[model samples]
Target chain A: MSLLAKASAAHLAQLMGPLDSPAFDWLRTPETGGVMVRGRMGGAGAPFNLGEITVTRCALTLRAGGAVGHAYVQGRDKTHAQQAALVDALMQTDAAATIRTTVLEPLQKAAKDRNDSRARKAAATKVDFFTMVRGED
Target chain B: MYVAVKGGERAIDNAHAWLAEERRGDLGVAEMSLEQIREQLSLAVNRVMAEGSLYDADLAALAIKQSRGDLIEAIFLIRAYRTTLPRFGASLPVETEEMACDRRISATFKDLPGGQILGPTFDYTHRLLDFKLAAEGQGGAAAEAPASGAPLPHVTEFLNKEGLIQQEVASDETPPDLTREPLEFPANRPLRLQSLTRGDEGFVLSMAYSTQRGYARNHAFVGELRIGRCAVEMEVPELGFAVEIGEIELTECETVNQFQGSKTEPAQFTRGYGLVFGQAERKAISMALVDRALRWEELGEDNVGSPAQDEEFVLSHADNIQATGFLEHIKLPHYVDFQSELELVRKLRAEATEAMSEAAE
Candidate 1:
């Protein structure tokens, strides 16, 4: 998993919607092995290392320039990272209520279903506990 | 068809059941009680509390019993439990001068205001095994003399009057919590001292011994070593005042070390302090010696380049729980990492053989 690349201050301001811009900007570049997302925590002017973390981030600018949605995933799933980043960027806007109902909840439900299916498949292999007894009689 | 080994969870459950059965031993034998372990194995409980950095005697005792008397495992249990508990508030610093001492002694002074009380010490006891102790219920409680009229003031205070020892100035500054925060290089005294107090006894002892064997040796004399109970207090924001939460037994060590004058500063005997949970005098003393050895840089002495002087190494490796966990975890399944390594080695060997043949041609 690649770390998110950093973004310049001017680009960050232009990218995110007005009202409550994130203190930091992460890069959402897709690499060969996996998607790399880097976190830029805290506000500008005195940004120090939060950490070089493996993440995937995506940003979507809405129509009417009212909202910018962003999402960040810890590992290298590009689509997941993009969706998460989009959610983050959108949550800052006035359209958060609609997006939450239409997107975030559904995505979470889908992930849970997929996880349950995988868990069932794994559990199928579990053998019942048994003990064998031997006698010389 | 070989279905890959996929019963890790089931195997783990079975292993746990087997372990429980093994721990219980024969059904005819009675199970060990928590009270029995607490009272009989108090030293193990003390070690757990010392390493765990928690003061609850009952919890420490329980942890010792659950961990089968493994001090390090008990410490790990306490530490894990401590993380889950919410910290309501920090308490005011306990005044060591006012400590109700059980054992107090000053190596620097022969006679001071308070006469030395060598209470419950193995210092003068012969190393030969006491047969009486092996035979249970052989000893009777000794009658207590009324507690000495306040500890005869610390010996270091007298040296402070002579201007020979540096007078320590107290500050209202708050120190960072090491457990909550990631450690950085060049830590302050509070953080360093905190790490030393909960550090592994064997590791601290080795580091302290190294300093004496000419590794960053800053000749130190034990100014005083005292073991006693001190009350813990907390300031209640709603109540608008401090409240006494509880009391804990502690061993405190203060070392007076030779501090040759630096270019700008005058020569005076500097201090190295150690404070730990319970009556662990040896650990406290070792910690004090190591603390002094690590202070060479701050005191403007030459960098002797000793392992004890290496702050990053000492602080990082001092904790046995972290060290042992990481060390023992290698026994767990690492097939993926090993497979990758195997592939890389094969590739390298093949490349090397090809190069050797070409070179011969």
Candidate 2:
């Protein structure tokens, strides 16, 4: 999975604690925008625009290692976008291993756990139907 | 002569204030929260999401609250909000074959590969109201079942292999975005399907019902109906490969309809397809029937002149927002037009009376 895909807005918000005040320049300050959502007839059919949704995006370059990181998240949360970008930048440096384990792994686990619990609730409602064979069949 | 009515700004302001008060209802009763609507009234949210063509449950809930549970009004709110967003690049066509299905059923087959998984449907429920739900602290949790493994193959594939069903040809041409552009006449299949998916559910349902009632009748069997979450991927030009963007819940229905062979063709079953955002099986199924009915010209079927078979009629009237706007506009001042009619009647009556007096003299 891509780092961006792994880092959902909620996960990033929870994972990213206070940054160490590392020198970084704003490559692109957080800005609110919209994105057109599209869908196809079937999974692999002709595409059409569903509608547009609000999004926030930001980009930054770490002064020390010159690693650039960008983030785009749903809704108008600028601070969430900035924090996500910061995490992205740190993931490229020597702190990559630490961040992956402490931040990314935990977030992934939490997401998986939530999905599993939901599935379990749904499964409880699943009905397995059986047909009784008539004598003549 | 009629003059335009002057401002009723104060009356309008007072009306709005009264409406706001009415929207809150009895203060003794608990106020409805966005979360409660999102969780408890999820089906309404699903309908709004499907019709609004936007899939955010939270936003749908908010719209419902703001509209005071008037679903059509809620849909309008969502549609207005959706028009302001920007255009990111289109994601690759979603892979429904890999959908983690919650509900899967086939009307044609008794037992098939992946088995029929009826996930969270109200199909077999008794229609009687549950009085238990009204009592406080009477809610009970549903039993949990483990998630099934492997993606279920589509039921139509079996018919496809036998050369019985019409083949769907893959195309790379960019389909038109209905939301971004004005609708054009004689819309192609993609455009028609797009309109039908976001079209008013009740309108589409009635159109589909018309077909079953012998108006442009096409014998249709639900080949497959599946509801699940499908992965949405987008090709990142910089990354040079498509990456998983997100997953969205979808309802897909494929209908197999009987078709007679034309002079140049052989008899084979044709398909009508419907896919929409969220678990909206009724909308999806209705869309498929209406879609097939609208394809009369392409299929070489005679124009029966039925409302369902008329492309212009179905497409034009399907949108609730458009229909409601014109329907509700009757409440607006029409004094100018009414006054003209009133003058014509007066003159005609006077002429008749004058002619009668002359005859008497």
Candidate 3:
């Protein structure tokens, strides 16, 4: 296999395409719990529980061959994974048309579908609370 | 309308579930037994054991299986496991002269005391592929010699008596383990030699060959190369004396190199050495040559600008696991950094375009 196929998490982080938010902006936001992803070396098999490694993984595709790229870190950061995957997919192909049709479109659709579903579910449970007062003139 | 997306925990759980399902695909097929890996994939096990600095065949096999044939991962597993293992004490150096030989040969002498037993080597065999193995047919049974079980004498002992070879003076000084200690610059001979012994076979081979092809051309003759089983002994604090822990097969290579005496010393033969796990003759021989070449500084010889002469380069880059790990880790993510670079590039281009347009007007 080519060297790219054997790339690791640290390398993946460096190759990640673009940041969604500026560093200052992310820093300004309130600190919250992070995501964790865990994986071990080996083909996905009856994997012996090789200790739980906390990882944050994000996935994004770019306008390239139907390349779905994934970035996984040891902690939670959906944005990081997404950007990493986007970069990976972008690195795979130079043809913008293929990238758009294959990677970017699917990722965009998936993101939209996810957002719409969440909005629909949240809308169902929306509660409006207000006090009505008659003005005494 | 927009909603904050959160399913990371659920997604991870689902992905793991899918991965597990994928790993054990079509469960109807016979699962691979650990013994099958140990026996069939013996070479893989050997590599893991050698690199991991662990000798357990079963554990090595399991690591190999767990790694899905990734040797470095298996080595990593073995190393991690080995670190956790309680250290009782260090083992005494095995008396290789007393080694029960399966194979012993000397290039310096036509006939040695122990005699040149060809033993089991692929040297004489034709390079043609065996059709029977391909067809999964059993090979011929191993011809067992009637157990003579005689103690073998070393080829070097004879030279030692005649004062032709330099005798190693016994010292109580403890040699440091390269794995335990971080490698420092201007490493001592012991430390440099330790790393070379456990170094990658192919890498060491090339370095040694480079010496032969006039890179560091130190005329090396394989004084002796012996492969055999030796008993390992560990000292028990309570018990007072050392006791036999176990036995391991080893390949020991000692090479006599041509050395023209430098300014301070008289002309005398010097030695290149290799001691490694298992019966790896090629690795042992290569190690010996490299070891000799590396000793140029201490032996008061001219520093012939050679790769072997560069101690830091040889010692640091010799490990396959470290080299592979650093090389392969580039696939992770760095979109955050990339975006910054992208912004910089775009900004630069915009500034350049505006400057050119103003000049034209």
Query: TM-score of A-chain in each prediction?
Result: 0.45, 0.83, 0.33
Q: Candidate 2 residues A1-137, lDDT tens each?
A: 34444346676666666436467899889876555555555434566555444556678999998998776655567887787777778889998898788777887787778667766655554556788988895
- Give stretches of model 2 more than 4 Å off: A1-8, A18-23, A32-34, A50-54, A118-129, B1-5, B236-241, B356-361
Cα RMSDs, all models: 22.6, 2.7, 30.1
lDDT of every predicted structure (CA atoms)? 0.64, 0.78, 0.61
Best by lDDT: 2
Which scores better on lDDT, 2 or 3? 2
Candidate 3: docking tier: incorrect
Better-scoring candidate (lDDT), 1 or 2: 2
Order by DockQ, highest first: 2, 1, 3
Each prediction's DockQ against the real complex: 0.01, 0.48, 0.01
Worst 10 residues of 3 chain B by lDDT: B141-150
Per-residue lDDT tens digits of candidate 2, residues B163-250?
Answer: 9977776666677878768899989888898789899999999999999999999999998998887765666454467665456788
lDDT of 1 by residue, A15-128 (tens): 333434333344434321211111010000111111011233354555545454444333235555444455555667775786566655554465445434433332332223
Candidate 1 residue-wise lDDT, B322-347, digit = tens? 99999999997777778889999999
The residue ranges of model 3 lying beyond 4 angstroms of the native Cα positions read: A1-137, B1-29, B146-150, B351-361
What's the residue-level lDDT of B146 in candidate 2? Answer: 71
In TM-score terms, which candidate is top?
A: 2
